[model samples]
Target: MNREMLIKLWQAHKNDEWPHVETGQEGPLMTLDTVISGCVVYVLDGEEDLDEQRRAIVSDCLAELDTLEIEINDECRSYFGRLREIGTLLLITT
Candidate 1:
């Protein structure tokens, strides 16, 4: 996904303006779950451009997403799963 799109989605979630569940996702909770999980991965990628402190923050964010219920599409699940593996590896290193 585009970096800007991820940022926008993340911002919307933080603002409580969740995506329209009926637009494509399973439902309200799943929408937020998938968005958040994806955002964590985005932030994980961004950490490479950030300083140690910022990277720590990103890793912390990833830490919180470990038990999230990502109820998105199969493609998204596969995509996010790959990112999650990379992100999880980075988290452990941090």
Candidate 2:
């Protein structure tokens, strides 16, 4: 796992300065939280499905990292976007 980015996010979260945004069930019908978890974690899901609550936390955490200007590579970003798209589809589909 890309511990570097994850560490940055974890640090930002610990410092209470990540994403600088609030996460809740209330907001956009589809939120980052509503989707899957952190991109890295998502990619490394290893066939294990994550609980919604955990996924939400991870999603917002990633968003926080993005806001903090912590760069995630293109591959990860692409995978992230794909995961988001898949989530959006699922939301719309079901």
Task: Find the candidate with the highest lDDT and give its number.
Answer: 1
Candidate 2 lDDT at 86 equals: 43
> Per-residue lDDT of 1-94 in model 2, one digit per residue for the tens?
3344444443333344223222442243234533343433443345334456655655564555355323444434544344444443322322
Superposed Cα deviation of residue 55, candidate 1 (Å) = 3.9
lDDT of 1 at 65: 44
lDDT score at residue 26, model 1, on the 0-100 scale: 41
Clashes by residue pair, model 2: 19-64
* TM-score of candidate 2 against the unseen true structure: 0.29
Native-referenced Cα lDDT, model 1: 0.47
Pick out the ten consecutive residues of candidate 2 with the lowest summed lDDT.
Answer: 17-26
| Residue-level lDDT tens digits of model 1 in 1-94 | 4445444544444455333333434453354355445545556566443446645655655554443435454444543444455444434443
Supply the global lDDT for candidate 2: 0.41
